[model samples]
Target: MTSTRRRGLIDIEIDAQKEKVRKIKEDNRIFDTLETDKTTLDNEKKKWFFTRWFSPTSIDDLEKRIARKEQKIKEGLERTSIDKIHELEERIRILELAKTNRCENVVWMDVPEILDKKIQDDYLEKFRKLPQKIDEQVQSVNITMFGGVGVGKSSFLNTVVTALINNPQRIYRDYKTAPSTTGISKTKAFIPEEIRKKRGQSYREHPTFKDVMHCIVFVIPATTNLYDRDDEALNKIRNLQQRINGPRDVKQVAIVTNIDRIGVPNVDMESVFKYPNVKEFCEDVSKVLEIEIQSVYPIANYHEEQKPTAAKNALALMALWDMFKCGERHIKKKLEIGLNDDQ
Candidate 1:
């Protein structure tokens, strides 16, 4: 009976050990599954963060795309602005009209001779059609002459008219001095002899005597005190203003004659405005001068006998001529406006 009891106890112990081993195996399997799941969740979270925060394209590329879009939008707005279109159209029209009505007042020439064939041809082509041109557009000029008495204002006028008769190349290169007692003369020459004839024989009746005179020339004297307070110079300016038919009918040019006498003491041409009360006087003069005066062109005004072959002198003369031509064009434009108004 003792032997049977001992065998039963050993069997029970063996069963208990088997049960413990099975439980240990199950716990290890559960731990492995949990570890695998945690690893998968961590990998997914990392992928989401990379996609949300980081861009594949560079920063420079992104800025360029934005800028291109802005430019396109600006261009579209500009294209749709009606006011801009109207302004551009108006400017185009004005330019076209100006081109169509351009005047050939001062003709260019290779030689300074009235008889030059080319110059004559140009003159005839323009002059013969003067009436038609004037009707289409009347040109206005303002002329100013500065010089001491005897700088040859009248003589210059004769030369200018002669040049006009044939060609502008015939412009007089020589001028004589006038007496001290007599002041330099300023006049406005107009086209169409009929107008001059009707106005009468006075200097005031010169075609430019009317407020609507077309051309202006300024004759500067050789050694005159242009800034003087005396009545002589002032009177000429006053007379010039009175001749313009209307305020808008004037154009201006400054002719400085007798450059030889320019640098004398108390007679500096450049410092003319520095004289006593000269600024006020000139402003007043401008008010009556009928045109806005821009600058002064120095002329040698040498006599035919006294002329020298100095290259510098010749260059100076050419420069003056060019300057006058530029001013002439400006005056012509103003005249065109007046003519358009009349039409």
Candidate 2:
């Protein structure tokens, strides 16, 4: 009957939607684990069957067991539609917008507050609790970059780091580029299989894969032409994204860089949308990468100087916010927190 009652009802619906999204995320995660395990089991069975065809006393038995496991995984996957997860996400966004009395894409002005230590500490604590090392995948928020070497991945990453720490030089601390003096051989005697990579390292690099990174940044130039090796590298990243977060769910932002060089350098750096060519490039890159166009951003990083500009700083904040939002959704899904949970 009252406004308070209406607000309370909306909050209740929001909580319900959050729970639904969380559950669906867990179901899809289980499905991913099943797929990974089945693949590995299949490979092991094949290796034994092929290598020890005459020596095996139980080759057929192993094959039968793997087939049974694969069937179970397939059934589990079929029971849960991936579309449900997308629906839940949209519903949650709508619900949150209604409750907050805000429009979609409400650019919060509290960047300094968000950069505060308390919020980050709280996030890191919860992120640590997210289930890790699921078969071959790390449960951290991943950002996969797909582009050439000179595409300004380092510069863009530096800008992001500068904004996060409120210090401009943070990006330079660990930033070192490894160059190949002798160019990569396309026609080598043996082109080794491209080794799989993820957010965290194995036992050699890290003791554990928990809360190591709140974000994973993958850099790729926007100039990667279609059907080229750079394009092929982009596909490798696409596959990695699918492998880590499944076909339907991955928090990815394609940082389409070199807008400064693509067209005449706009002295007005914030005028990214002002140029029709820039907008077209953004669309084209997203289409090629098979990601949402909204996830594609045009950025120009500090090449000659380390100082931040108002326009460039705004873009950096935006990119970081996008990445953080991805991390937040991922943390919620992976942790499976309830309304009463401390997170």
Candidate 3:
């Protein structure tokens, strides 16, 4: 071979040897780094396992601790569930009792006979003389007329006043509007003639009965069920009863108005009166008011009276008058009792 070719061959062989050596060194360095990282990871894992699984005094102790915690959680849940169940049961009991009371039916004259005969005789005498006693006086009663809006409450009041002032000879005054924004007006009117002719001059206009409302007439709309506004109506009635001055003022009556709108398939007023809702409403009102409802009168008011054959509206007015008269008699009896007690 020529000298130049031999020299080039020698240089290529040396370069190839040097490249192989460099690649071997690089590979060794990468393996060393990987080994170190693997060792570190293994050590950390072992340490964590030792601390978590082996650090306890014994396996049995660890097991006991776990079981106790589980038991505590279970017991807590059970206690909470039991407490909730008890609360629910108590609530249900109250509701059931209220329901039972609401379903009960009683007659007005069947009120418990607890009075002495002398007291009864005195009451009867006063009751008989009530008309003469109240003659020529303005007797005012404070009434809390309750029902939903559009329940013929205003219509009932108008009917009552109209009935009171039906005679052309008497001058009747319209009551001032109630201050409610909902256009519900509860007013106190002086049925001057009824008061004057029925009660005596000594009985003056008194404030809304401080004790019991002399009369409570629930004016229900005929078209709806008694459960209509049941919760709301019951709440208001309860509140009013609470506001009554004393037990004596707790006179109550139920007037189911709007029979004309009821529009039965084939029923008369007498048949309609047998409706479960009507009976239920009457009973509920009496229970809530804490008084025996003096009566339940069904009333229907259309433009023309002939449309409702039952004279329901007129009868309702008569019911109101009867309630007022009964309440007045009660008041006089109470007053007499007070006088006797004072003596």
lDDT (Cα, 0-100) at 1 in candidate 2: 62
Full-model lDDT for every candidate: 0.40, 0.52, 0.46
TM-score of 1: 0.34
Model 3 per-residue lDDT tens digits across residues 1-343: 6555222221343455455445545444444444454555456556657776444344445445445545544665222244554554554444333333322233333222222233333433433344423322324344545665667666666554443334333222332432232122354333223444655553545533232345556665545443445566555555655654364454556676665343421222323333345455556645554556546655544334422222332354446656666566656665555522211
Q: Which ten residues in a row have the lowest lDDT in candidate 3?
A: 110-119
RMSD of 3: 33.5
In model 1, the Cα lDDT at residue 249 comes to 47
Arrange candidates by lDDT, descending.
2, 3, 1
lDDT of 1 by residue, 1-343 (tens): 5554222222343355444445444444444444454555455456657776544344345445445544554665222244644554554444333333322232222423122234334543443443322222333223444323565565555443333333223333432332322112345333333344664654354233223333455554535554565757646555555654355444455555544333311112122222223333333334444334343333433244232222223323343344445545655565555444321
- Specify the highest-TM-score model's number: 2
Q: When superposed on Cα atoms, how far off is each prediction in RMSD?
A: 37.3, 29.5, 33.5
Candidate 2's residue-wise lDDT over 1-343, tens digit each? 6455223344566788788778667666655666665676577667777886543545555556557656766776454576877777886776554444322232322222122234444443443444543324344443434444566765665565454444434333233321222111111111013332333343123323232333344555646564465565666666556654542344667776766665524234533454556567777767766767766677767666556444555566666557757765765665463222121
